[model samples]
Every structure is written in C-alpha cells, then in structure tokens.
Target: MIAALIALCVFALSGFGLSFWLRQKQDSSQPGEAATRGAEQLSQLRWRDFAKLVLQAMQGRGYRPVIEDGMPADGIPTDGSDILLERGGERALLSCKYGTGSIVSAQSLLGLSKSASLRGAENVIVVTPGKFDDEAERIAVPQHIELIDGSELWPEVRPYVARPQEPTPVPPTAASNIPLMAWGGAAVAGILVWFIVQGLQPDSEATSPALAPPAITAAPPASVPPAAATPATTKPVAPPAATFPSDPAVIEQHRRETANAISTLFGVDRALWSTQSTLMVYLSSEQSDPVNELCPLLERYPELASSRVQLQPPQGSTKAVRFKQCRTY
Candidate 1:
C-alpha cells in the first residue's frame, strides 16, 4: 500500500510538471511566427555570431567538430567564418551566408567546391539563411556539395533563438498558491490509489475452501442406460467482400474542376493535380488552414471526397502538409 501510494504521488507530480511546461510553451510564439521572427534576427547577426549559429545547427544534424589550428576553441573559425565538420569518417567544410534576401551565386559555390577539394574534404555544405540563385542550384546538383536554404535552416536554429519574454499577469498571492494546489492534487490521487489497492486484496473473514465441508451426492442407478449423444452443428463461412475500382480519367476531371473551384477562394494562389488521387494547393501565406478553409469547400464536390489534398504554404513557413480528404470520414 505504501509503495503504491508513493508511486501514485510521483506520477501525479510528473503530470503536473508536464502540464505546466506545455502551457508555458503554448503561450510562446507559434511555429509560423517564430520562423519569420527568427529569420529576421538571424539576418541581422554579426559574422561571428552567424558562424556560431551554423555550428550549433550542424551539430544537431549529427556532425561533430574537427579540431584544427585555424579553428578557435569554440569549434568555429576565429575570424567568424566557416567551420569543419565530420560524420562517419567523412569530413565536410561548412560555410555560412547571412543577410536578408541574400542569394548565393554559382561562382561563390564553385569557389567553395575548389576550397573543399584542397582541404581534402569529401563533402561541402553551404548554409544560406536566404535563397540560392538558379545557377547556384545547377552547380551544386552536379557536384558533391549540399545547400541549406532559409526554409530548411529556420527549423534548425529556432530552438536556439530566445523567445520573446512577457511579464506574468498572475498576482503574487495567486502565483504562490499554485504549488500548494499541485501538492493537494497529488495527495488526493495517492489516497484514491491506496483505497483501490486495499479493495483489490483478499479478505481474511471470507470462508476458506480448505476449511469448508464437502457436499454429499447420490449416483443414478446403472440399469438406466446412457442416452444417445447428440450430433455437433457447424456454422457456414461467409465469402470475402470485393474492392471498388477507381477510374484514372474520372479522377483527373475531378482534379481539374476542384482546382478551378478552389482557386477562387481567398488567399489561395493556385492548385495543381500532382497525381490522379492527389491534389496540391498552394497558399499565398502561412496563415491559411486548408483543412478548415478548403476542406469544407472541397466537400461540395462529391467526386473529390475520396481524393487526397496537400497544402503547400509559402516559402520559409514551417507549417506541415494538410490533407483535405482527411475530413471526409
């Protein structure tokens, strides 16, 4: 009983702590807002700070620091430049490009590639907290180099950015009572657990089977022969159900009609039929929730009720894919 009560208390306390932590986190900025704010702050950072940020982001991606003479004790260049990273016995030189609306050029990427080859590095990664030019994309695609743009980089450094601090609205007296309430809740849970544990235990006052006397019974006469055994009955098995065949041409028509209708909605840029059963809708901003907005609009088309819907938010938005068909069932 005592051990169970202790365990219950621990569990209750842990739950309370988790609830409080989650509430605080929810009170902070949303993912979309944080991504926008953090990107702006990242662009304004000094070269040294930007390099450190890239190092931290790379470390989270399973890359470890490769100590060298030019590198400082912080695992980054002393001049606030690039850093060397290694993973699985392979070395990669990482460079950071920071600036608002900055675009990395093909010439810059070509130079970085040559520099990596001279350093005996097997891979190269250029992290620009902005966009990359078309030419740069072509150059990196055919080489042993990887590029991390703003949309991909924001999620990595979001945790490192400090959340905007706000003053507590609760009065001092009310804030002081929170811990007492938590303890009271824990104590109540522990008592309930103890009572349940006690109830499950066997009672000593109940009659024991070994101590009770056996009942006497008389056997039937052997002259009356045993009756004939009855035959066993068997149940019939049911046949398997058939699947419905989906038409590719009809689904394509539904996609086109649905796309035209959804394009008329506010804030929607355009829609495309990526596949026969899949529809991709592009949004003008991250504030749009297609599941709530577009799902209802899509329900008007009965043919598309079974098709999948994918929402593509604007660049740099961390919002995940939203499916329209998920709401049908």
Candidate 2:
C-alpha cells in the first residue's frame, strides 16, 4: 500500500516538473523584436564573418550551408549569391548590408543588391542596421527586396526558425501484412536455396561415419588346409581410405571466399578490394583519401577525371598483386 502511494506521488511530481519546465522555456525565450535587432547588428560583418553568420541563420532554419569565398571566380563559380541556402528545394539569397543611414536610394545598395536580381535570385532579402526611408520602402514591394531593419528583423527570423516536430506515435505489432508478406517470400526463397545448396554441401555426417577407424580382424593363421602341397605367394592389400577436408576452419574459409566472389561478380560487394584478389586493400577513413585526393588533381588536370580503373586478374599464381588505372569518380 505504501509503495503504491509513493509511485503515484512520483508520477504526479514528474508531470508537474515537465509542465513547469516547458512553461519556463517559453517564458525565457527571446522575443521576436530582440532577434531582429541582433540580425541587423549581424549585417555589419565582412564577407568571411558574413558567411559564418549566414550559416548560423541557415542552420537555425534547417538549411544546409556551404562556405564559398576567397576562391578564384572560376573555382567557386557562385551566381553572386551573398548568402546561399538550400533546403527542401528552397534556395534563398540574402543581401546583408550594415549602414547607419536610412536606405533612401536603391542605387546605394550595390555589389550585392543589383547583382542579386540579375543573377536570378528566387528570394532576395536586404538586412540593414537602420530602417528604410519611404523611397526604399516604396521600392521594396515592386522589386521583391525584403527589407530587414532593427525593429522587424527578429519577428521575421523567428517565423523561419526550424523546430523539431513531435514524432507520431507507433504501435508495436508483428502481424502486419507487408512485413508478413516480405517474411513469407524470404522463407520460400530460403527453402528453395536450401534445396539447391544441400547437394553442393557434401554429406559430412555420412563422411564422418565412414572416416572412423577401420576394423581389423586377426588374419586366419596363414594355412592352406586341404591343398597344402604347393607353396603359394600372395601380395599384401592396403586399407581403402578417402581424403576429405574435415577441418571446420578450412571449410568456413572456403565458404567465405566463394561468397565474396559471388558478390563481386554481381557488383554487390562493398569491401575495398582490387580486381586481382591478391592485393589486400587498405583504406583511409578520417578524410576520404582516394576520392578527395582525386578532386584536386582533377582540377589541375581535367583529363584525369575521365580515366577509369582497369580490372584484371593476376598474371601468375603470385600472392602479391598491383592495381592500375586509378582515376576520379
């Protein structure tokens, strides 16, 4: 009885704590106005710093960000996107500017704003430290240049901010038709395969019985009972035995090799191996050694990108092998 009371109290306390914590987070969260002001301040950074800030905003909105600056024009080849964002087929271009004066002339915001429209920007937003003047505000509606000032910036950003959605509840059931159908198909295939492989798998159980030590009976005293008049000569006979690989490890290794060969032939193998089968593969994990190394080399020599890896068996019965025709993916 006491234990039940303690359990009820614990449940009640947990509910209360969860509700209180949720409400507290709601209360302490920054207001939209404050966020806009912070964004306005964020506009004043240089290109490198601007890239970081844009990435920060993009991450908040669940957009994947890529830093592309300080490279040759051909190297990066950006479409003049000051800040680029990609998310679920939505691409955004942000023109960030930090100036204290009112934005009166559209001509004033150059380098990014003008280049923005010409570059086919789907969405254009201009962030500034101060509010837009009447002329700037008047031009915004027509030009589709979203203005972000100290007052309205945060509210706009807040709406765009990404939040984790609650997961839908799922029931634990194993009787569903789809899974059952899949399992049924699998079972049928397994049975068929077992029938096929049984013949290929030697009858080791029978083999084991046959390989047991052979019986030996004392040879009847070498005597010729009735016809002892003449001496006879006979050749010795040897026991009949067949050599089979009964070692478990050797059987397993052979099985693995056969499976690997089958997978490679079907192009379903994921293991890193050269075609020769003699070359042991070594891979670089931290940084994709083989692929990453090729990209830069391709930049230097474009022809290398078109090459291919030649697949061939080893020349001799040698265990050591070599690979040729290394190229980009």
Return the top candidate by TM-score: 1
Encode model 1's per-residue lDDT on 263-284: one tens digit a residue.
Answer: 5444567788897668888987
**What is candidate 2's lDDT per residue for 228-329, written digit by digit as tens?**
756687888888643435676764453343223222221122223343222222321222123332223222323333333332323342333234344333
Residue-level error in angstroms, candidate 2, position 199 = 99
Give lDDT per model, in order.
Answer: 0.68, 0.45
Model 1 CA deviation exceeding 4 Å by range: 1-33, 99-101, 164-329
Scored by lDDT, model 1 comes in at 0.68
TM-score of every candidate relative to the true structure:
0.40, 0.29
Q: After superposition, how far is residue 209 of candidate 2 from its true place, in Å?
A: 99
